[model samples]
Target: MLESLWAEMPDRFRTIDLESNALDTDDLTAFLTDPRGPGFRIRFGQLPADMDREMAWCCWRIAELGGRVPVGVLRSLIRWLAATVEDHPELSGSLMRAAPREWERSIAAAYARRNGSLPGRFWQENVGSTLRRCYEILWAAYDQRPWWRREVWDPTLDPRIPLRPHEPLGNHAVYFQQLEPLWLRIAIQWYFKVSLETGQLTWSTVAGPQRTALQVFADWIAGHDPVPPPWLREDPAGIRAFMLDFLSHVRGLITQSGPNKGKPLSPQRVNTLVTCLETFYAFMTDHRETAAQVLDEAGWLRLGPYHAMLWRHGEKGRRTRVVRERRQEVIDDTAFSQIMSNVHLLGEPIEGGGLGDEQIMRILMLVARTGRRISEIRMLDREPLLPLDRLCGSTGPADADGAFVAKLRYQQTKIEQAPDTVLVDAEIVAIIDEQRRWADQHLGPRWAQGVTPKYLFLGHNMNRNADKPFPPSRINQTLAVFARRLDVRDSAGRLVDFNRTHRFRHTKATSLLNAGVPLHVVQRYMGHVSPTMTMEYAETLAETHQREFLRYHKVTADGRDLPVDTRDLYDMLELDKRTDRILPNGWCLLPPRQACDKGNACLTCDKFATDASFLPELKTQQHHTLQLIDERRQAFAARTGQEMSPDNVWLAGRTQEHDALGRIIDTLEQTGHRTDSDGRAVRGAGVAARTDALAAEHDEERRP
Candidate 1:
């Protein structure tokens, strides 16, 4: 049977025996001594007389898997298997009859004994691959399952995921071999493959956390008191009880491996496990016939509406809570500046205190400057930059500072209708230009062959056609390492967490809104499908407003100290939550329930208040009010041939506004250079200066 299977496979494998599953001593000698084969010239004369045929079969299997082990390494693996079977005697049949744990123990023993002529460490390292290949090939041949039903499902082998030649294989394989209950494993394989085909789950999700979630469930079920069999026996009620128990079990799980070994499973992780369980059962219940066909059992027909609705009631609420709790933290200006300044260090060698990749530096620069999601940046096309004139088909107006030079159309992976293009400045254009040159040079021969690279940031290894983009994992891992090495800290002195690149997106959105960019414009810039998603960043804006508001001491309209604490009033009035209370000059101190009867006479109303941050707008307002009084007085003189009376209603109101502005300006200027309670310079101190410069520029632009 093994001979027929070997003969039927693709010609990648070398033949062993045409008539028998096992090769004798002469057959093994002839195979190893053959000069036409993979040149295994070394030999082992001493062998277990009874197990020699099994050893020969193992070697032939290894060769079928394309492994070229040295003769010494091959002898060590065969000797270990022979020694293990001799000691146990239960595993004396074919190598595939033993479990993985048994093979692991024998391999450990071989390494310990320095089995064969190889050194102990060398044997320790080389024996694992030999045993693994032997087991993989034996199991594959024994089962003779279709590609999807096999232990490993490679996406590249699937016709659904478009293939590229010689590209580096990432986490592309979904392994079902370790999962328990043969029926459950086959069912998951069917659901996963079908999900990919139907566009329900992406290949990335299947190869990543979806597979992990399934594995967690399988491991849990294997250890359950009523271990799941190849065919489930539970009724709907029993299944519900079992599922609830599984949820609790998953909730109590502690990480047994990896960096977070001792920590409890996080809420996000627990949610993923529960959601996967819900989705799998729902799939199984919906397609009972398909499940039954895959499992080759009628037991799956028992799954019905009850099992399908297991997690529907409360799963969405739990997911929302987890999402809300995991809101991205916005990186502030100080920390962001420090990060950009030290970003070039990422290109230095790892041993030289850097992340050790020049590609990472350019990628990070683009991410920080563009505020694009990491996925968008990673999957950018080879030519993503277009000049404004070229994009619009006409020369667009350029500001004096020339801030807009081109438009960048990144990969719109998340939202279908969201805008993919963003106006970029010269700096961003330069970065894209630099990357384009680098990518073209990197794809040297391939570019010469007229094959255009698929991505701007090409994968570094095994991608001869430049078909694969740089991996997102590399960019994230590099950012983490870069942060740790630089010890980047926020204003609170806590280490800046760079693990989630989406924080950059949050920071960018917050900064734009604070700079007074309209909400609709910010929504478009973020490529959000709705304003609601962009409004999440408004919370950061509220924090900034409150911080600035409390930074300066406040005075009443009469220039007297406030009778109440400014912070207390800010909270009691809920000023941060009230848009109506926001004034062009400062803030409205009126209570929410109170009706404002003071039309345009806010200057005389007791509900009005001003702070140092409003000094620029106040000064501008004061100049306009005085200039208006003079202009009106002259216009009245020209019409009636006499100056307007001082008691005129309009003139009187203008005088009141002018006097009120003077009082506020005097009070603020007298309180100049004041700091907050922490003795830090107030954030609004520079606002006044920058606003004045902007106002002066506006006045110059309006000059006759």
Candidate 2:
């Protein structure tokens, strides 16, 4: 082929020279690549002997004389360089693998993945349009992040979006860095700009966080160590200490910003942050060379063994979504109480206070009782923010019956299945109604009329004073003032917080969950997208936690309904009586309905052994009595990652206690049978009769 080219252009060997130039350029690029090519050298006769000597001089000379290189010519030259032998690799693999006529079918297949599957040419023709609409939904959600407003984004240009970014929210940099570049490339696309639309940049929706992180990262690329701003610094050995300091400083600010709105991060914001960052990595990775250096270093702290270290220590602390050793934190309980106690204008000097404080308190009380968000409380349009004007103008049984049944309604929530109207239980409803009337009398007749605001708790002083509801932040700030007055000293007057309005929400959620509100129900009420989030928001009540902790090792078994009282530390220890002071670690089964009374059961039952609630105490004796029970039950219907019952919450060891108990019950029923009707049954007339006789004999022996 080369000989034929030389023969055709024998005078100058123009064709041969051009072909060699393309080859040389390709070879030269491969060499500069550090890893270099399999065998590379700067041979004198090679094309582009030195990159600078060729293009630098040509570029400089062309620019000197007011000459402009036509984009078409530049494009052709670059395309030529890309195409030669190397260009084929960049060609779409999917396209190349398919038959020419099947190319459309192949593209359709890629798109069908998004819309599920569709047959034939229908998807080929419609998927591009459908995919655009799908992305727009995501784009709209992303626009809320606000960085999309920047000038760099072109609203008109449609860009290809990759997968989401990698979010190492609580993870370290080392591990994250390995995947970070890939994630960034997925999110950011600087490849080309589209100016077809008059709207904001479409890519901005998902790329905001990645873009910000990238820009921040770019600054660090210029230098290292103690990287500016977000590029945190710390000795690996002292990372725990550094993190503690940082969290201590930042918690207050983050809390105030409402990130921890009585729950973990709001699902929307969390999704946004995670999605945006993952996409950011996707974008970065597209340019492999740039991605390697950029993403790896960016989240350096987020990667490595340090993350596991932090994770192991993350759970013992207070607060949902607790990170690796954040500095000390506590609920702004004092301020919360102060604010509520002074809800009426009766007890405190109100700063932003007024009927508004009462309204806020009432709102808080509602959230506490009903476990709803502040927004849910305020935006409840059906229920007037305040209580009714009066209970009864005239008093009588009939007149009292005339009292208005105050109820909340029209759920303004993201969840559609959630119930709308909260039936205002008696006690709180009357108080709220009275407060509204009091406010009207003080603020004037038109006050209630003018309070057409979207939110009801505002008395002024908040950033987004839309329609007059006080901003949630300002209210929280006021609450902080109370917290400062209360936590006045952290363990040692090392004053920690001012106030946080979320205390009420947390307290309420905690109370409800502790009281046994199903986490799913709580999630719906709190407007959480997931139950995991519900658990985070609901501060674990010490009462419930203690109870659970005390009885964690014990559970009902053998088809017998275990009384919850078995969980009480007081019950387990028989603290009331010195008899059961030390519970033996090994299992001990109490006789059915045979509760030991340490004098507390007298009110409910005359006999001490009658009521199940009056258990004397756990004896400090070791008896692995129930071991066989757990073994059999857990053999089936087990949920543990380990062999344990998965039923036992604290069965962290390699024991699926649920299955164990299941196995035991199956065995007890199957083998315990004395010619019984069914083998699986736990009890039979023969067993019951015998057990009763034994119990009676024991009772007689123990009788005082």
Candidate 3:
């Protein structure tokens, strides 16, 4: 079976055993025992370059001493060798020479020399089993075979690619291994590889959720009786049914890991999975010829409709489900200020409330201040800091003789565009300067001797020779440790985990918006391509608006009940309308018209309403009205030579207006309404004013 399968594979996949010489017991013993021996590197190097050399050496020692390797050990070696052969086609012949048959013969000879028959037909059964397993492993590794020559039918179920141990949510590794009809797996791998190399995705994204999506599809297939491969074409309705079932399964199933373990998968996760699978089907449709042998012409015709069904499923799921009900968690103002104060003290002794290593603290501060994505900050190049004087034509607000403001320039990976540059305050510049000095003192010499990029945040793993940017995981872990040490908590008193670095981004964006920064400015600050994306971060702070309403508009003068209908309030605010009218005293409730007939008489107009907070302004206006009335009376006396003239007739109307203004002011003052020195209504004062008005009305009613 193994030989036939090998023969059936394309010429590119066939391994040739060119070595004629058989290894002696003495040579095998030295090869296994000594790390310095030629065979040690030769055999282990066939695996991943980063494979554990010590573990491989230990496995070899066990095989040498016991005369028969464990099944797990053999399987592991075969998998590694197959992977090596797949990556380096030239090494296929070398790997073939070191196959399990040679190992079995050598082990049997060693046992026979010891006057012992090989234990329990282990050589006949286990060795043959291992060889067959090796064949299966090799077939899967060769999934990148040319589209035209790929396998049309699915191979026999290989034990090497077992069913998932648990419900696979985003397990790409398992899915890729289990995905049948060799061509389909190859095409999917091709799509992802192209996507990564073409800069359509980062390796982290591809390795993570993208792979998980494929795993979910594979799991969906496995849930069926006698699982069908993804390439097996069904009608559009059949495909729709399958997709609906997959979605149902995902929704019904509980998560196996993370904070939400044992809970039903969030709608967002399900929708994301659906979107990923939809993309996968679209990729398959684009590369339809790759699966030509498996999918007939009719099947190919169904791709468009099937892809449509997948899209609809995703869209419908999103529409019907309350995906992400909770507002985005952000660092509140008080918490943010506290964090900033403590940031610089991070690396100090724990007794002094320092978490130590001020580098991470500096990173957090940078994110909080700049609104930069964590990726942009983490992947900062060697000399990313630039003086503001250099960015602007000359010395500007950002520049002060020697203490110039600086801007950070780095590649924005989220959306491919020109390098993003954001201004940093003097404090942030100082932190950057400090970090630069630290890197120069610690990482410079070692980096100069190696080939790693000059990343600002260099990895600490010198043993592994990793001189790249520090992984986001490390930064998050560091934050989590510090958060626990600080005993941080939200307003609800729940422990605040700083593991999510994104909250800093939200905190920054929300702070900017709350500070009355223009939407476009916030958008630019956040490096968002669209204002809509920035709005998502900005809009999550509904609590801020609620607090503002309670602070300013919740009460009215005269202690009158000013009940606010939320829907009416929303209409009055009219946040979505660009033409919404906001007046000095209050918003104009009237529709747009030619002119104001009331002549800015907002206090007395039925269409207008004033908060008791405007009492001082109303009093000043009344004084101005009285002066106007007296001036008109003097003019009439001079012209007609009489105390009561036609001009004086307008004075009666002016007196009535003055009396009306007095009544309005008296009502507020009588109702106990008070204003601050600036004339803004005192918070909660409206409640008192309303209480007094209600009492006065009650007294008047009783007298009547």
Among the numbered candidates, top TM-score falls to 1
Instruction: Tell me the TM-score of each prediction against the true structure.
Output: 0.65, 0.34, 0.58
Q: Model-by-model lDDT, in order?
A: 0.68, 0.36, 0.54
For candidate 3, write residues 224-267 as lDDT tens digits: 67665454445677766767777787778789998899999887
Candidate 2 TM-score versus the reference? 0.34
Task: Name the better of 1 and 2 by TM-score.
Answer: 1
Candidate with best lDDT = 1
RMSD, model 1, all Cα superposed?
Answer: 11.5
> How many residue pairs clash in each candidate at the backbone level?
0, 70, 10
> Model 2's lDDT to the true fold?
0.36
After superposition, candidate 3 runs with Cα above 4 Å error? 1-184, 197-201, 230-234, 293-308, 311-316, 319-328, 349-354, 387-404, 444-453, 462-466, 489-496, 541-543, 550-553, 563-704
Instruction: List RMSD in Å for every model shown.
Output: 11.5, 29.3, 13.5
Kindly provide the TM-score of model 3 when superposed on the true structure, using C-alpha atoms: 0.58
Candidate 2 per-residue C-alpha lDDT over 1-704 given as tens digits, one digit per residue, 9 for 90 to 100 = 22332233323122212222333322222111234334322221222222212222222222222222222232223222222213234333211222323433444444355447644554334433322322332233234333322223322221222211211110111111222233333223322122113222332332444444343334322343533222133445554554454333323222224445454444343333333333333333334444335434354333434422321233223333542112223233554455456445422445534423555556656665665656566554423533434455755442244344454553344344555554445565665566455544543322322233343343332112122343455446555654544444443345544343444556566656666878887776565656775656444544434433342222222223224343342344343444432222222234334655523211111111211111122110101324544554566436544554455544422233333333334433433313223212121011222345778999999989
lDDT winner between 1 and 3, please give it: 1
